[model samples]
Target chain A: MNALALGLRRARFETAVYFRQGDTVFFTFLFPVVMLTIFSVAFSSAGNFGTKPDGSGGITAAAFYLPGMIAAGILLSGVQNLAVDIAVERGDGTLKRLAGTPLPVLSYFVGKFLQVLATSALQIVLLLLVARIAFQVALPADASKWLTFVWVYLLGITTSAVLGIALSRVPRTGKSATAVIVPMVLVLQFISGVYLSFSQLPSWLQSFASVFPLKWLAQGMRSVFLPSTFETLEPGGSWDAAGTAAVLGVWLVVGVVAARLTFRWIRKDS
Target chain B: MSETEHVSVRDLRKTYGAFDAVDGISFDIGRGETFALLGPNGAGKSTTIEILEGYRDRTSGDVTVLGQDPGRAGRDWRGRIGMVLQSSGESGNVGVRELIAHFATFYPNPRDVDETIAAVGLTEKAGTRIRALSGGQRRRVDVALGVIGRPELLFLDEPTTGFDPEARHEFWSLIRLLKREGTTILLTTHYLDEAAQLGDRAGVVVGGRLVALGPVDEIGGQDSRIPVVRWVDAAGQREQRTTEPTALVAELHRSTGGEVRSLEVIRPSLEDVYLDLVAKHDSTATPTGVLA
Candidate 1:
């Protein structure tokens, strides 16, 4: 068979295998739903949670945390999935076997890219469904807002997935993969406005967050679901679609190059 | 380019850091021959094989497989060679038949998947997931995968290492069957008996060099050194090492004026010559500072 056909076949087989694993399916699809449920319930009553800015009124916690939940889904699909899967495949010598075949290195990455895209699409649909049905959140009414969400989410996921593949090359063993991913996940979540609004953070922290794709992604995502007036709270009183796209595009290029240069198909021990 | 030489290597060298894994070795395997590379662990057999397989780049060497330099050969060249690596960690979710069918697509011409499976004695387990197969049965699957392309040259690296005695015999028979089909086979094994049984000619590798290469029986070719004669003597038993076994036996018969009891002549086995050759190679190379 041609390389592209073989690559797609292998990639489909890999995706099927991932779905069969009970724990993977739970973590990839079910975990987000569970977290969204708990967060929605805890934040149901407007005045019961954290107070609003200026202490004049209490912001509805559900409104404040919905964006974080969506960002978390992106992280799960992009970073966590790619990192752990590549590391495990390397540990098991599957990559080594593929390296010897006629299948080129780019084909493997293409397969992974397609898998991540499909999974991310599924994650976004599920999150939107849960928000509308369970929490009574309003759906995007305008075509432009929905288009913004789709592009931002796709660019965000593609950047993170490629970064994860690049980063996974550093860990030689599967056990070390978890150790590397956990700390990175925690740090990125903190800086990305997943736990708090970037506008509420200190100026220095805001500037630092601006350097990463995560903060821009979360901001871009929030711009879609939140009111157009919320744009006033942004660094500029506008949605910097071009800026967000640039940051993600740069990261994508860097990630693809680094993965090509550093990735090792065979085990160091072997 | 000799007509007899099906495989050839000249000044093959591979280095990792400051160490020479394969330090300038050369050898040849004749057409329709089963050649065995015999060595201990860390003796550079694997390095040499990896270079030959084009899985690893060599530091410097002139090497050819099927008359093409593996390093620069295209897909068609690779299709002509089949390698059963020391370990293959392919996914186990697919049934054996499905897996073999998938690999068969890589070649321009492939053997019938079912017939190949049957040749490896895995017909009963064709539908079984590879993960569920026992170690021996899994090894048979590996063999089946390696030969699926009906390659002109097959490289079997420690192919029967984990096999039971019965399974090993079956594997040997399969290899012999391949030889009958005019496929040149190159194998590396730690098992001496396997080499003795399968190799038409065996080469002993030591300290990154080939110490001896010839037909299994004539490796050392020290036939005149002495044969050990053992038999029942006047008291109980006697043994003697002598260069002239026929004269000794004749003298013993004349002295006894009758048939010799329990007469037996023992010659050196391939294992004995192999160990001795490796030891001599080791001692000679050490003083000059050779490294494996």
Candidate 2:
């Protein structure tokens, strides 16, 4: 059989396994929903801190935080999930065994890439459903708004998946993978508007957050899920769709190249 | 380059800096023959096997597996080879059947997944998640995955390391069954008994060199070593290592008037020969610093 067919088969098998695992499902699917629910409910009745400017007459914190929460879901599934899994597999000899097989290395990764996409897709959908039901946030219904979501999510998953895979090579061993990744994810979450608005963070912090794809992802997602009047809450006081695309696009290319350059079939042991 | 030789290496050397891990070894594995590379821990047996498996490169040598230089061999070459690693199966949650069947897709022609599972004696646990299975059962899954591709050459690296005695026996038979079906196997094992039982020919490596290579039992010409005859003497003591024990026994028989008490003949076992060779080699060679 051809490698593409086998890769898809492998992808199906792997995705099924990922879905069956309680921890994987919890992290990739349920955790995002839970966090979104808590954030939506906690900020629902709370007074506005930034004199928020969404044109819905009153500040709907859920609507404001909806896009960032989805971005968080995307980050967990695409970046943290893939990075941790690859690191653990590296230490356990799975990658080495797979390398020794007749399977093409690219096919094996393509299989994993599919799993990341599946999990991230499920995460985004679930978070959206929670926001719509509990917070009364509207879905992006029009074709053009849906189109924005398409490019943003596609670029988001592609960049983060490759970035996750590239970063998997950094940890010395599987046991330390969490130690290496957790801090980065948390810092990005704080700065990239996952929990607060980009404009709410200090000015110096805002500049730092703009360098990463997470900030652009959250910003791009807000463009899809929020009203155009909400752009004043952003850093530049406008919805910079091209800026989002440019930063994420550059990261997408850099991540692919970085993954190719840094990936190792065998674990690096001192 | 002979028609019957499936794998061959000449003057193979692997060096990490000034330290030689595999030093100038040459050997041949005949088609469909089970060849065992036997050595104690860190004897460079794994290094040699990895070079043949195309997972490692030799610093300087000519090597070939299935008539292709393994260092430059491509995917088509890989389809013809199979390997079971020392440790694996730290995999995602999946049943035995699923993982084995999935691996079969890599090869152009693969054996029936069910048959492979049955051969490895995992028919009962086919649907059980691998992490829930016992360590030995997980190993059987590894073997099933390895051989499902119907590889022309199978590499088993310390395959039975942690298996219980019964499980080891079953695994041995599974390998025996594969060999009977004309699979050329090259395995590395520290267990001398495993090599003796499964290998038509065994090579003993020590300190990065092939010290002995021949039929399993006759390694180091143990069979040709003299046997010692022991019997009660006027001194009531014993001495061995007699070159002419049979005639010596006759001479002593005449002296003792055929009343040979506590009479026995002692011959060196393969283990004795192996230990002797290793001890001698260790004493002579400078210790290479640990690489692993």
Q: Report per-candidate DockQ.
A: 0.32, 0.59
Interface RMSD of each: 3.6, 3.0
Residue A153 of model 2, lDDT score: 91
lDDT of 1 by residue, A177-199 (tens): 76777577767778778776677
- The TM-scores, one per candidate, come to 0.86, 0.92
Model 1 TM-score, 2 decimals: 0.86
B85-192 per-residue lDDT for model 1 (tens digits): 888665466679987887787677898999999889999999998889988888888898889988888999999978999889989999999999988999999888
What residue runs in model 2 are displaced by over 4 Å at the alpha carbon? A47-56, A266-270, B1-3, B222-224, B230-237, B242-263, B284-292
- Give candidate 2's error at residue B44 in angstroms: 0.7
Where does candidate 1 clash, by residue pair? none
- Candidate 2 lDDT for residue B152: 88
lDDT of 2 by residue, A35-134 (tens): 7778777876886434546633454777777788888788888888888888888878888888777888778888889998888887777777777887
